[model samples]
Target: MSTLTDRYVWAAVRSIPEKQRGELEPELRGLIADTTDAQREKGVSDADIERATLLELGDPVRLAAGYTERPLQLIGPRYYLDWLRLLKLLLVIVVPIAALGAALGRLLSGGDVGDVFGALFVTAIGVAVHLSFWVTLVFALVERGGVQRIKTPGDGPLLEWTPDSLPQLPAPAARRQSLVELILGLVFLAVFAGWFVWQQFNSFLTDADGTPIPVLEPALWSGWMYWFLGLIVLEGVFAVWVYQRGRMTMGLATLNLFMNIAFTVPAVWLLLTGQLINQEFLDAIPDTDADFDTAMSYALPVIAFIVIGVAVWDVIDGYIKAWRSRNVSDTAGE
Candidate 1:
């Protein structure tokens, strides 16, 4: 007469080790059936037998916990220390390599090596701070049973976590998060724009003569190329903001990313090529003007193509995002 309708109990039954599940199922079913038979013979009503059987088994959640041997916590105390240790290891290995490469690049390119080194130092700290913040949050949530919410395909049956089991983030905290993102986005855009302008200014000062500067400087002609980089970076920032705000359509965001890559490839290619050709390197001598001209003729069109492609993509991507957001707003209103 007794039946197991609780999802947690059923999930636990299914979660037993494959060989164990096969054996446990028959035994548990026999016990339930035998208990019901005994209860009926004792003159207990069918409903009472069912209720008593469930009661004796205790809370389904606790019972399930016993059967499911897998760890249900994502970042428990055991993992937290391990996570920090791994992160420290990564920082030690990656940061110095990045710093050394960046410092060497500045030295070769005739830029401020001290400034580049300082930037590397800030970059390392920034990376650590951001990674630590997210890791700590994951661990905090895991401490409160957050991992149980993740149901994978291999999981035999669903055991849904109730509202009481879910993490509750406060409205003030959510608003503060929004504010922080907005500030960060603005800061990124401002920094990118500033860099673009500075490059253009330096190029203008050096391009006074028709001849190429002794070193690679973004000059009159090269100043135009920086626009391509600026457009790509700006579009990227906008796309990211829209994504975080949940206003970005998936198709449009993908398109934006593609546009960014398209713009990025040629500009970066030319910049790298310039670096390789510059007299500072151990390449095959003066690198004939004919070779440079040949390279430019091929490179300019590719850069132009990417620049145009990005422009068109940005306009289209922006319109698509606006359209989708408007549709969502209308649907919500109706």
Candidate 2:
């Protein structure tokens, strides 16, 4: 037999069970040989005959499936839609919950921003992988076992399909908005809260002895920083609340406005009162022509302006989202 014929026969039988391969390989080689002889008799060249024979047989994997009576796919058409729906449902429900749990655990364990985020990513991926593996395994078993519909003691077929069984889907735009808001809120809060603690132990600015020097006043740790951290936690909780609700409402938006004010007012006040930055750390600067006090006198107003501007934008954005959500609801109702 030609080398091409040998390769084709080998590829087709390679995946068949060992006991079956003994029978299938000889059968496959016979078919290839018979086809090659017929084509050669029709005045085809050896290379052309081999190519034509293999092409007629099509993909080796599919041919193997035919010989073995086994599916090439993990979940066949019978269970594919069901498996897909279940996987989507599990991912949407489980991933966020896993992320939240990981984030909270890391926070309570005194993890910094990097540690908390790393935990969230690793946990989400692990949960997703496990969910996919188990779900696929169960569906593959069902497909192989030739099970039709699962039934319960006092119920109709558990996997039966009906119009009434379809889920009421939320508005896609609103759902996406809520998710974005939740993610951004949680990330912002986590970074600031973690940074507040992390800065004390790690900094780019170091003393002459190479000790870390924090930019924020260490005195704030004794009192004001706790309040800021509390607000950060509250913001995180509010982010979850917004996502769970799936759309902004007037009441929720109002609450968001107040939360922004609560955070930014104190922040601006601290900046203006010269209570935010560490004077000692500034004095430790190696070489600078500009005076620290003169620089801060100009810098504080700009920082205050940026802070107030962000708070104002946040408030307005909340109201706008709430208004748009209300309008969408009204239109849907009508």
Each candidate structure's TM-score, on Cα atoms with residue i matched to residue i, is 0.27, 0.48
RMSD of 1: 17.3
lDDT of 2 by residue, 250-309 (tens): 767777776676578667877887788887677777664478667778989999999999
Winning candidate number (TM-score): 2
lDDT of candidate 1 over 144-234, digit per residue (tens): 5535434534322233323122111113554576567667867776776666555433432233353323333434234334445555475
Question: Against the hidden true structure, what lDDT does model 2 obtain?
Answer: 0.71
- Candidate 1: where is the Cα deviation over 4 Å? 1-175, 200-216, 219-223, 229-233, 236-248, 275-334
Q: 56 in model 1: Cα distance from truth in Å? A: 46
lDDT of each: 0.50, 0.71
> Whole-model lDDT, candidate 1?
0.50
Give the poorly placed runs of model 2, Cα more than 4 Å off.
Answer: 1-169
Clash count for candidate 1 is 1
TM-score between candidate 2 and the true structure: 0.48
